[model samples]
Target: MLDILIKQVKVLDGTGNPGFIADVGVVKGKIQEVGFITRKAKLVIDGNGLCVSPGFIDPHAHDEGCPFFDEAVLNKLSQGVTTDISGNCGQSLAPVSERYWKENQSVHALINPPECMHEFTSFGKFLDAVEKKKIGVNMGFLVGHAALRIAVMGLENREPSLAELEQMKVYLRESLEQGALGLSAGLLYPPGSIAKQDEFVELCKVIKEKNAIFTIHIRDEGDYVIESVKEAIEIAKRSGAFVNISHHKAIGKKNWGKVNTTLKMIEEANQDGLNVGFDQYPYNANCTYLNTILPPSYLVREREQLVMNLRESQFRERVKEDILACREKWDNFVVNVGFAGMLVIKADKTPDAVGKTVSEYANALQKDPFDTALDLLVDNHLDVIAVYFSMSDDDVETVMKNPYGMVGTDGIYMKNKEKTHPRVSASFPRVLGRYVREKKVLQLEEAIRKMTSLPAQRLHLKNKGLIKEDFDADLVVFNANTIMDNADFIVDSYAPNTGIRYVIVAGEVALKDNLYTHAASGQVIRRKEF
Candidate 1:
């Protein structure tokens, strides 16, 4: 007898193979059989006409530190995500001193930042705590290089000495040995961004030694985009480490059509004996703080210095220069608001400003958009907000078809039913539903591979992203044609997808009939270091 059995289902086994009719049996939290199963079970699911595939894995996400105040992860489970990798862009809730957590009150208060932030030093300890807590979804992590930088060297902009670099390497090695999937660096953000190529190579060497991967948010994704990508590829070559570029994109209008160029470079690198991969959310616009367009020079100084620059009489002139540089390169900088498509969501403390665009707010207060952005940052004290600008839909389609690419949600699992970017709640569904079903950019089987098997291979997850017998029983069942994401950027747009009937994590049903049981059966997925 099996623990659970699903009868009369079409299995899309997640190996890029054709689907076939079969009855799958599960026992002891593992798939025991996949063909015709003549077995009795404790529970049985009639999966007639439904499509079953290996659980989808999000290669990039930001749900690590704390649960969103809204319990909308069901939005994810309903669309078939079983595992998610967080700690991207060198940010997570970890490797902190108590003083640090207390000082960074905003992240802690809202993210409900975990105890692991203060208790752990090595990546192994972090994983141990997650297992102990049994968080929602299976999680894999990259020991954020920014966190390590702050741990050793405070949030200062000085170059590390030989001794400091060696210390960082020691920490990286400890993390990999303890089971970090790889090393992640956000070269577009402070501290880590200021790090030179030699500094990055030193850190990546530890990842290489453990046979883990190195993922990076490139230094620049706008005017200097190509150069920044070249730098990352060079680091991979010098260190001999597998590289995963996080949310690969050329952000602004001037650089809008460069996707093919970037893809070609990546393909050529693959031919050059480099193990390279990338993940992207299927959207044209990106969400981040409005200040992301500023060059590195603007952020080189301390926060106080940044404020001083903003307030000084000569600063406006300098700001004008920077803005002109941006304007020349990009045709239009849309200050998107709620209905305008670039919505403002997730400013937890203040909700009044939720639906207003930069232009709208600026006009109401009689200020320029640039000035308005700085004032908003000061008012919010550096809290993050979402930005949705227009990206060519064609670009989204072209990138999704790339062989080395996979999918991820750059934001958290949201459930407020308010105006927000669709990526937060609709990424997977939009792909499996709209893109694959409506447009036919990819076959259902191929899309599942990108969302599951491809990511599993990139992260080196064991016995997952497949429907093979003896593998862990993480799975999803849905009506492919009926599946559609209802989440949108308009009012009350947080509704879950349709047609996804069940989601199982480690043989336990976390979602049944599209409703989550609030069961936290997930484990911390760590790389096995030999």
Candidate 2:
């Protein structure tokens, strides 16, 4: 007898193949059988003409801290995500350094979550704590370079000393040995920005030696984006590391079609057999901390010191100039897209500012948008979160059409927020409904494959992201005709996807009939060590 059985379902198989009518059986938390199923089960679900595909895997995310919170990834599960790759953008929960531990509260509130950090001194210990949380979806991790820097250098802007370099390599090797899939670098962000090209090449060499992957968020997405891409490609080529470019986009209106050239470069790299590709969100807008709009140097200090730096007249003038430039200079998204393109989505002590742009707020205050943004940063002490309307929908569609491109929410764990980007709750379903069903950009099977096998292969999860026998019984059952993402950008951001009847993570139903069953049965997936 099986643990649970689904009868008369159209199976998509998650291999980019055509669908076939079949029955699936699950037992002992694994997929037991597919095709004709005449066996008995403890629980039976009639698919009612729904499609059953392997669970969707998110290739880029920062939900590593979800385990500490009570909500525990309800937003991701609601979107049919059964697994996600977290510790993205050069941030991880494990391998905490003594300096980072002390400065964590003031320096990085986003990455440090729970009292669990004290119990773990290494990557293995952190994964142990994550397993104890039993989150709603399987999670794979990538050790972050910023975390290592904080542990060793404590936010310094200089290159590591020889000893410091060796220490970071040891940390990376240890984490990879303990099941970290790869190394993630956010060079545009602090701590990681301190690393030079030679530094990155050395770290990539370590990753390559361990038979792991290297994922990077480039130093710039506008203005100097091509130079940034060259830096990343050079690191990969020199070290022979498998590379994944995270959230690949050409920001700014002039840079709208730049992804065309970037994608060509990626293809050329692959043709030369350097193993390079990118993952992207399917939305026209982007989300990040408001402090990013400030000059990178102004953000290097601690919270209060950083605020003081922002208050300096000279720094403020530099910021104004950077935000108004339109050439190959500093990477400023606000200047490139214009202030009208930016809207605040999250901030401190400013609930009314949530849905309005800096320009709108500027007009109301009778100031320029640059001054408006500066005042908000000072008022909120650089804790604001905003959305940037930077990318073109055509570019988003074009990137998705690439055979090497895969889907990722880049969304994190959040619930019951007053205002948020629709991508947080709508990425997977939006792809199915808008891109696949409505626009015919991709076949349903091809879309499912991107969400499944491709990401699994990228992360090297042998037992996940497929519907084959003996695979984990993580699955999604949804109606193709009626399935759609209801979350909107201006309003109703928390609206769940429509036509998803059930979501199974490891043979247990996490979402059934539009409600959580409180059956969180997920595990932390680790890479195979050399």
Per lDDT, the best of the predicted structures is 2
In order of appearance, the predictions have TM-scores of 0.91, 0.96
TM-score of candidate 2 relative to the true fold: 0.96
Q: Mark the regions of model 2 whose C-alpha exceeds 4 Å error after superposition.
A: 104-107, 312-314, 325-330, 415-418
lDDT for position 418 in model 1: 44
lDDT of 1 by residue, 170-209 (tens): 8778777777777888787666667889999888887778
Clashing pairs in 1: none
As a TM-score, model 1 comes out at 0.91
Output the lDDT of residue 399, model 1.
Answer: 87
Taking the tens digit of each residue's C-alpha lDDT, what string does model 2 give over 140-240?
89988887777777777788999999999999999999989899988777877767888878988998888788889898988777877777788889999
Model 2 Cα shift for residue 240 (angstroms): 0.8
C-alpha RMSD by candidate, in order: 3.2, 1.8
* Model 2: per-residue Cα lDDT at residue 186: 87
Which residue pairs collide in model 2, if any?
Answer: none
The count of residue-pair clashes in candidate 2 stands at 0
